[model samples]
Each structure stands twice: as structure tokens, then as C-alpha cells.
Target: MDVRTAQKLVMENKHAKGFNVTDVPLEVCLLQGEIAEFFTAWRTSEGDAAEELADVALYVLGLAGILNIDLAEQMEQKISKNAARVYERGANGVMYKTTPEQTSAEH
Candidate 1:
């Protein structure tokens, strides 16, 4: 299913299950927790790491629905923005992101 469909289903499931459906802060915290779980599962080489990632995605959809956000659009915009980003290698050989405005300011 598409993100919008999944988002709608997530909210529907949340409401149907009597879960907190309107609490943005709580939703953000829950999403953060799910992310941590995903990271831990991956780090530990757990067989259910994909499941934990699914949990993260579910929470993302639910939270976006609650916030009335067009997640797909936002993702597309962000991806485009990232694609246009410029990076410079630092003294330590690590790359750091720098915007065009910042580069001009430094010059």
C-alpha cells in the first residue's frame, strides 16, 4: 500500500484500538522509541530487526496522519533538497554539509 493509504489505516487502527490518536508529543515519543528499538535490533543482529523497522514506519505513518501532513510530499521535497546539498571535506577527512548561502558567506 502507498504511504497515504498506510497512514489512513494507521490512524484508523489507532482509533479503533482506542489508542492515543491526537497526542502529537506522545506520538513523537513513541516513534522515537520505535526507532531505538529498530536500531538495537539491527545492532544486535536480531531476526526481528525488520519487524522493529516496520514498527518505526507504522508510527511514522500514524504520526503524520495525526499531524495532517502529506508525508509523501514532504519526503519528496526533502529528498530533492538533499540531492541539491553540497558537502565539503573537513580537515579530518570527514565530509560536512554546507548550504550555498553558507559557502557564499564564508568566501
Candidate 2:
């Protein structure tokens, strides 16, 4: 199923369970928890990685649905933007954005 269909299913399940996640901060925390679970599953190589990843996606989609955001469109736009990005690692070991000119000069 598509993302919209999956999102709809998640909404239906949430409604059936009376799970009202109105608090944005709580929702964000839950999403972060799911992300941790996904990484744990990846590191252990024991649990179902696909299920954990799906859980992360569910939380993300649910949050977007609650906010009335077009997640798919946003994802596409972000992908397009990232595709043209040039990044550099700082002394602090964080990746920072670099201009196209800087990227060309590095080559």
C-alpha cells in the first residue's frame, strides 16, 4: 500500500484504540523512541528490522497526519534539495552545509 493508505490505516487504528496524540512534544518523543528501537534492532540483528522501521514510519506519518502536512510531497521536496547539497564535516564532527562553489573548489 501507498503512504497515504498506510497513514489512513494508522489513523483508523489510533481511533479504534482511542489514542489521541494531541501533544506535539509527546508525539516527537514517541517518534524518537521508535527511532532508538529501530537502531537497537539494527545493532542486535535479532529483532525484525523491517517491523521497527515500519514503526518509525507509522509515528512519522501519524504526526504528519495530525499536523495536516503532506508528508509525501515534503519528502519528495527534501529529496530533491538533498540531491543538490554539498556537505563538509566541521572540527566538531558535525556535517555542515557547503555552497556549490565550495564543493567545486574542493574537487
Candidate 3:
């Protein structure tokens, strides 16, 4: 379904398993670990990579749920904002999103 539903399920599972419900720091670390696991699985084998990726998404949704963030809404707004944005390579060789004021100043 949607991200909010998935988030609710993730938190429910975590609660059932007696995980750290309010520990944002620990959850952030665990989310990072899941990302590492997914990267390793992706590099080594494609079959297990999907499972690891699911773990990563699960942790992400769980964290969103814990923080009471409207991830789906935020993602939609961010995508819309990004769509109307301009990007340019900076001196550091990294693409940076320039604000409207910057775009005007550069003109």
C-alpha cells in the first residue's frame, strides 16, 4: 500500500519484538547498518540483495513512524520542489541545487 501503512506495520512489528521504540539514535544506527548490509549483498549477490534492500526500507519506514513524519507527503513535496529546481556542478565537482535567488544572481 502506502508508506504510512507500511510505517504503521513496521512499528507494530517492532513493538511486538520489543525493539527500542523511542531510541532515535539507535534506530538511526540500525538503519545505517541495514544500508551497509544491502550494499554488501548488492555487490556480492543479486538474490540476497533484494532482501537486504527490504530491510533497509523497513528501517527507514520504522524510523519515519517513530518520528511521526509524513514521509509520503514529504516525499511528494520534495519531488515537486526538486522538479522545479535547477542544478549545477560546483567547484567541488558536486551537483548543487540552486535557489531562485542564486539563479537570478547568476544571470
Candidate 4:
């Protein structure tokens, strides 16, 4: 019931009232905090971990909506780009840049 209400709110607020790149960094930081809390709960077997994770996912979805990003489509684009790269798969079945330091050097 709570989840359904959240989903309803998400759908209702699908469109953004305005554009703002400044909000992205703040939202990302909050997302990181949510992730940490979620993992902490999960590792300790605190039953609310799943709900925390769901809340974070919903927040990210809202961020994507505000950016007009279409999260699902953008994720597909990411997959396509990743598949074209030559990196080996990690335990998460996704590959990351070889080295964070060297990768940042290139950028």
C-alpha cells in the first residue's frame, strides 16, 4: 500500500517544473548516503534495508525525471556503450574503467 502510493506520486510528478544542474550534485550525494544506509541495514539484517534501497531508487528516478533523462533508456545507452568497450566483467557483471586515477587523468 505504501509502495503503491509512492509509485502513484512518482507518476503524478513525472514532469519537472524547471531545469537545474546544481541539484544533480546534491541529489547524487544524498543518493550515496541512502546507499550507505541501505547497505549498513542489509549487512546487519535490519529488515528496513530493502525499503531504504527502494526509497533511494525512487529518489534517483525523480532526479532522472527532473533532468528529462528517461532512466531506462539512458541505462540502455550505458549498456550499449559498455558493451562496445573492452573491459573485463567484474563480480557485479559490469565493467568499470581500469583505474580511477588514470581514467580521471584522461578526462
Candidate 5:
């Protein structure tokens, strides 16, 4: 039900099939940084934004290839994690809050 349980299940399932590319957060964050850098360059335009974006996108794609993760799926997960609060139950949902790391682990 929780993130820890979900991660445990993933690890358990992976035990039987011979898992690969275990760096989930690292790979995801690396791509995210690249994405940020790309947008930053695009905004500044003091450098080659197009080339920077292309290279970062390609590296991100390569990382995705190694991890066998779909960018769309990952993006959806990221959005979902960021879009709503899991702790909200009553009418006072706005009171609930979490950190960036906690949000990241949920995905």
C-alpha cells in the first residue's frame, strides 16, 4: 500500500527473474537534471540550447534504454507523485505536506 511496501514487492519480484539496471532514482534524477539543464539553456540562449537539449535528451534516452524504462510512464508517475497528496483523507487536505525526497520515492 505504501512506497516501502511497493519497493519491497519490486525487489521480491526481481529476485526470481534475474534483475538488471537497479539504479532507479539515480537514473531518473540524472535525466531530470538534464531536462532542467536543457530548459535552462533554452531560456538563457547564451549557449547552444538546441545542441545541449539534444545531447541531454540523447543521454537520457540512453539511460532509459539501459534501465528499460518508458519516459512517458515515468513522466506520468512523476506527475502523479507531484500532483496529489496521499495523506489527505478528511476535508483538510491542504494541511498535508511532504519533502522532495519523499515525493520522489513514491514514484
Candidate 6:
């Protein structure tokens, strides 16, 4: 399904459960909690990891729907920006953005 369709379904599901995403802070916290669950599922080799990931996406899409944000568009824009980014992966396995000069210097 499309992002908008998924958002609509999530909103409906939330309302069905008598939950509202009006509280942005609470929604954010809930989203963070879902992300933690996803990681835990991954770490433990849970077969339900995909479901946990879906929960995260549902919460995120629901929150975006509540806030009237076009998350898909924003995601596309972010992906485009990432595509043009010059970054280096550190020993800690973190990706850090680098300036053109820094990139050239590294080479």
C-alpha cells in the first residue's frame, strides 16, 4: 500500500483502540519505544522482528498523519540528500558527513 493508505489505516486502527495521536510528545515517545522493540527483536533473533519493524513504521506514519506531514515526500527528499552526501564510516561503525576538502584530504 501507499504511504497515505498506510497512514489512513494506522489512524483508523488507533481510533479503533481509543487512542489519539494528538499529543506529539507522547507519540514521539511511543515511536521511540517501538524502535527499541524492533532492536530488541533483532538482537534476540525473534521471528517477529518484521512485525516489530512494522509497528515502528505504523507509529511513525500515524504520527505523521496526525501532524498532517507528508512523510513520504520528506523521506524522498532525505534520500536524495543522502545520495549526494560525502560521508565516512568510522571505526565505531558510525557514518559521519564530511566536507569535500576533508574527503579529498582523506584520499
Spell out the clash pairs found in candidate 1: none
Which structure among the candidates has the greatest TM-score?
A: 1
For residues 1-107, what per-residue lDDT tens digits would candidate 6 score against the true structure? 98878888888988899897689999999999999999999999975889999999998999998898988899897787678789999999998988543355664
TM-score of 1: 0.83
Per-residue lDDT tens digits for candidate 4, residues 1-107, read 44345544564554344423347787688779888989989999976998989968877776665566667766786787666566668999997666333255674
Candidate 3 wrong stretches, greater than 4 Å: 89-94, 101-107
lDDT by residue (tens digit), candidate 2, 8-103: 788788778987657778889999999999999999997988999999999998898788787878888788878888899999999998965335
Tell me how far the alpha carbon of residue 1 in candidate 3 is from the true structure, in angstroms, after superposition.
1.8
What is candidate 5's lDDT per residue for 1-107, written digit by digit as tens? 64334444444545566644467677677668877877888898767788878767555554555565666577777898777645544586465554334645664
* Candidate 3 residue pairs in backbone clash: none
Query: Which whole-number lDDT from 0 to 100 does residue 89 have in model 4?
Result: 80
lDDT of 3 by residue, 1-101 (tens): 98888988999999999987899999999999999999988997855998999999999998898898988899897788788888999999999978663
Which ten contiguous residues of candidate 2 have the minimum total lDDT?
98-107
Residue 10 alpha-carbon offset, candidate 1, angstroms: 1.0
- So what's the TM-score on candidate 5? 0.39
Candidate 2 residue runs with Cα over 4 Å from true position: 87-96, 100-107
lDDT of 6 at 5: 83
Which of 1 and 3 is the better model by lDDT? 1
TM-score of each: 0.83, 0.74, 0.81, 0.55, 0.39, 0.76
Candidate-wise lDDT, in order = 0.89, 0.85, 0.88, 0.68, 0.62, 0.87
Ranking by lDDT: 1, 3, 6, 2, 4, 5
Task: Determine the backbone clash count of candidate 3.
Answer: 0
Candidate whose lDDT is highest: 1
